[model samples]
Target: MTGGTPGPPWSWVWGAPGPPRATRRRGGGRGERPAGHSRPTPPASGPAHPPPLYQAAGRWGTPRAAVRVGLLCRFAPPQLPAWPTAMATVVAQRLSHLLPSWRQAHQEPQPSGQPEPVFTVDRTQVPPLFWKPYVYAGYRPLHQTWRFYFRTLFQQHNEAVNVWTHLLAALALLLRLAIFVRSVDFWGDPHALPLFLIVLASFTYLSLSALAHLLQAKSEFWHYNFFFLDYVGVAVYQFGSALAHFYYAIEPAWHAQVQTVFLPLAAFLAWLSCTGSCYNKYIQKPGLLGRTCQEVPSALAYALDISPVVHRILVSPDPTTDDPALLYHKCQVVFFLLAAAFFSAFVPERWFPGSCHIFGQGHQVFHVFLVLCTLAQLEAVALDFEARRPIYEPLHTRWPHNFSGLFLLTVGSSVLTAFLLSQLVRRKLDQKTQ
Candidate 1:
């Protein structure tokens, strides 16, 4: 009213104290018109601006900021002055630019159905001595679950090479056996006893070694059992090697002495290896060498067992003078030593972490050298068998094709011994843990 507001009088308005309710007119409804009264017509166009309460106070004449704020804050408490609506509009425009950027910075739009990447962990997650470089995740023990280990066969990790190398070696040994059977009357020979045993032992070692490599990392328990089997394979192979060496070199009189000492000693060591593996794995002693230390005694035993054979070769009237074969035998020994060094030292990977993880790690190198060593030993054995060509004197044994009975006896006894020792160690460890 102070600013001379322009509108129809309030008395004629609908909700004010105006006309009586029964006399109110309805637009276009049937009704009687009073004398000299004309019907009102609607406006052709709407009002140019909104009502004063809703309009910007400044109407964009100068800076409309004050007007916009006043409009925006008109309903604020009487104690507070209203802010300019133009200022609010300017602030809103500025915020509009920042909102998109803020969203992009903090909330990226990912694909609808994409899966999260698989996570890999660190070496601290695995067993202490068994920790391998380049292996990131999935280091569960064997008893936990089958999926984890089975997945490891397909996944890229440190043990990949170790497992595959021995597996390929097993296949190669099988091929070599097939070729050897084709070339010689392996079953018909009187001296086939030792050769057959050597082949069987060699095959067993390769196969077991491969299997252990594949499955040993599953858990400490699995590690102990498979490593025990591997140790037994080593002992059997070593025994067969010494037997063949002595069979060709030692006389019939000394045979009893060789068998008495070497066979019993080999069996004992094999048993020791089994229990040692169990102790190291279940006990988890910091300094104990569960799988690797077993090889030391075997190495010493092999050296002692072969001493007589070496002496016989040196003193023989017509020693093997074949140059290539001799060189191969020497190479075989050197490679075996190299394999032992790699197994003990964990080379290449040890010296340069992550460098040879996928392909040339120490364990894989050891497997390769083992295959070469076996090939060289086979060559040397064949040459020695040829050099000492005895008359065809068949033995009174039943297994004419192979030493099947002996093979079964040796492997079965070794497995049973290892199992008993493992069970004993497991029970003790469980008690301690409890």
Candidate 2:
């Protein structure tokens, strides 16, 4: 009893081992098992090593490099034949190191609610040769979302494209509209009524488009109605402006100038009626909606996961409506396309002859301007600099835009240069004041 002394407290017992068992730790000796009986590892004192990810054959960059290594490992001419197990162990060691780094890094807590560190993969990189889908497995819905978006040409996407396309178009038109409202257009044209009407229509369309985009995002009923209205407005302007082209008509005593406004406008309305009634169902569930359209989720991993606060700011809505007016800008686009078409199709003046028939006079200048506008529209579509969604990405997507800009600059400069040359040759002297 004296030798034994006092026993352990109440928690301890005479016969049993301790409550918390000791993990089996590896002893530093020959034929030792790894600690905790978890995973195995090569002798720790062997040498420094790269992570498993760094050693992956293909991971070293380029399939050829990996192929070269694998070929050497398996079929080398010399006596460098290593057992598969040994090779696998070495490779596994490297990957094991790499796995811990990123996993641990992401485990680091941040104010943002995300659990893992977002991979800031550059979007412009060689479009993930394979295995990209796994990257954004969490945001799979975004795949369907963007799919619904791009399929608009085939079917309506709750005003996704209609609202946004037109909104973007409006911004472009506003650029042109501003130019017109400024001295360049107002000073030169004595007949400002047409210009004013045209500009007003543009502004109205922009407002409608933006409203449609926002409201439609809220519900399907709103989406359908807003989309319908948007289509109507589009057709109206298309036909109205076409008729307005010949608006430089002699007013009759009885009617207000017999400008065949009804004809073109009616054509547009008829198109809407026919389209809405005939392809209503088809347009709603367009065949292309879930078709070949794919996002390759890894494509914009960085951009899509950007901070929400910055996103809110850049897409700032109008203070009046609390929306940044991304939707409103679309109306401007509708106006521009319709107006530009009208001008190109009808105007037959000395300064800006638009029609094909009005050949001899200064019609060439208008033709050139129309071409420039078309090119600008195409450029905007390709570049989408204003949208700038990439700013929110974990990584940047500026390269595609850089390429797009170069293409636009080249195309526009060439078109402008050609038109100017033609203008210089065809200057009807004082025909400019016409």
Candidate 3:
């Protein structure tokens, strides 16, 4: 009675609530029943109902899209003296919209539960540029962005664009390439234009890209050469893209046979392969990465020597844990093999169609392989991000700023998605032929 409910909890007190608070009374005393007698299912307690809001992925949050936007906001340049508090307020409110009725937004619990919920955070829901997908891929670290990026200001690092460019580009190019391949008439050149340019542009970009990095560090004179080459490579990409789609526009019916489509492409190869016709005046002979045949056609102009050096370095076997030089040597071997693959396929030969060029049947598979390789580079990027984490005074924070950590996990998930789709697509195509 002192606590308000004049009768005992099990006394069938229905709607007699002064306030809802924990009420306890000695269960053994004044029960008017003998000890050990099964307490008759202590009538009904509280409301015989569950709360209106349901538990999902642990703490209840508002709509998912709102959460992703909150994440993107975390990367904004350092706030002015008057803004951290202001920005904090706004971010908290935005997060509140996502937190379900069961949980408060932005308020992390004393100890978050295990098997955290991975939400579908949409960057668009938060603002002017809504389409960008900046979901928190992994766990947010227990620190701020400043604590994560380390740099005083949000300056883009060397590998910033390198990683995002491929990631963002992959979405668009992968789709385009897949469609172009599907549209092929098995013989027609017209519809297969995108693929043609994609290969050329990819090689040209890669060649110049590799050249740019390797020489940019050597000297300014060499730097200029590689820089110009990089630009020229971009120009080639533009041409390849347009030519791939419409080069044979004037002769639509000619694309009826896949061989006809690709044969003219073989001519284009002559253009790509013959690169080193001019001496570098500076770069040594046996040259770093190019061919020198002035007479060969455009299609066979470029060589594939440098890319292996880069691709192998990407997934280098752990140098610290593995035999230190073994990883480097393994990468070296992969590098040369990739280079050989490129040179053999792109380089001109007297054997022409009968040579190992016939072995280049898995170019489509290689495209997927490229995607996997890029993901590996991204994992390295995340490692870099993790390494830059800051030393805060154990701030009173809720969520951690483990962006890189979350990103690595997300990469794995994407790989799984890719594997499932790859198998399914292969099955469907294989079944159609039988």
List RMSD in Å for every model shown.
Answer: 15.0, 27.6, 30.5
Per-residue alpha-carbon lDDT of model 3 for 84-199, expressed as tens digits?
Answer: 56679999998787667447445554345544422222323222211111221211122223223333112332223333333344455455546545744435633333344445
| TM-score, model 3 to reference | 0.21
Q: Write the per-residue lDDT of candidate 1 for residues 1-434, one digit (tens) a residue.
A: 11122232222231223222223332123343343343332123312333353344445443234334433444445413223555688999999999999987787465579553232335566666466654334343435345556566666666666677777777877787787788768768767667767777788888787777667766666777787788677767766766566555454444545544555555455445544554555556545465455555656666755655555545455445543345555667788889989877877766676566466677788888988988887777676566545511221223222334444555677678678767976676588579
Q: Rank order by lDDT, top first?
A: 1, 2, 3
Note the Cα lDDT for every prediction shown.
Answer: 0.59, 0.34, 0.34
lDDT of 3 at 91: 94
Model 1 local distance difference test score: 0.59
TM-score, predicted candidate 1 vs. hidden true structure? 0.60
On TM-score, the leading prediction is 1
Better of 1 and 3 by TM-score: 1
TM-score of each model, in listed order: 0.60, 0.27, 0.21
TM-score for candidate 2, residues paired by index: 0.27
